[model samples]
Target: MHETRTIADLALEVRSKNAGPFWVTMELFMRDAVGYTIVADPAYLNASTVARLYGIDADTVQIFRLPALHVVKISFPRPVSQGSLRDRDIHAGQHHVPLALFPLPSP
Candidate 1:
């Protein structure tokens, strides 16, 4: 039986924070090059996936692949401005939960 692995399982660290007042950034620090390749694959974690997960426009998502660092970085527009009345997470720290919990595609 194949055990389903999630992003959290492959990444050494998964974190999210406010890029600014209007955007949030998340980083996936993979444990190795193989893990990085998996997370960095567009088919696995692209703008479309991000949009669906966050309920935001796909066009607003930006994914950065850093092979050298074995990291996948993503940024997206904040639904509400930081510190605004409607903002629940001022630092955007909790925003990575969904992505972290997302299961990797089966091979």
Candidate 2:
């Protein structure tokens, strides 16, 4: 039989690096922690999706179960400026980039 896990479990796995690499921000981690503490509800999430939402690039997404208080570690290629990426404007008819989602173990 297949097992099912909650989003919180996945989050913990990501934080711990027991799963894989994912790009997550300090703010999103905080929100997830607080939301869990307050409501105990979990939402399915992927690093690339979160990055796109935050305007971070796909290459920077890493998978790991990071502590809620841990600082976000985002690095860019030498020619790519992090600040510029943050301030970069989306062109007309832009679409989301394709990124692979890490797999999670059954709960």
Candidate 3:
């Protein structure tokens, strides 16, 4: 069986912030090149995968891999407007906690 490691173990940082009133962005910073390659692959960080992870529509998910920076940036439409009465995250920074728990195949 393949060994697995949570993103918290593989990434140096996992965070989220508001892109705008309508969007929230999540970022993953890898500690090394191996971790970067694992998460940066299209098979892992694409729209479908992120959509499944965030429980959002696939069409709303977008991801960018910054190899030079060892970062994976993901963005999607926000369910509620930023700072709206129903919004739980005013800065959208708390939204990435679940992603930190995502299980990845360990290297």
Among these predicted structures, which one has the highest TM-score?
1
lDDT of 1 by residue, 1-107 (tens): 88888999999999999999999999999999999989998878999999999999999999999999999999999999999999999999999999999999887
Measure candidate 1: CA RMSD. 1.1
lDDT of each: 0.95, 0.32, 0.87
Worst 10 residues of 2 by lDDT: 91-100
Which candidate model has the greater TM-score, 1 or 3? Answer: 1
Model 2: per-residue Cα lDDT over 1-107, one tens digit each: 75543333323322321111221222123235543332222233445544654466656655334445532322222222323454242221111112112233333
The candidate with the higher TM-score, 1 or 2, is: 1
Report RMSD (Å) for each prediction in the order shown.
Answer: 1.1, 11.3, 2.1
Query: How does model 1 fare in lDDT?
Result: 0.95
Task: Let me know the TM-score candidate 1 reaches against the reference structure.
Answer: 0.96
Question: Residue by residue across 14-45, what tens digits does model 3's lDDT show?
Answer: 99999999999999999999899888888766
TM-score list, all predictions: 0.96, 0.26, 0.89
lDDT-better candidate, 2 vs 3 = 3
Q: Clash totals for all models, in order?
A: 0, 13, 0
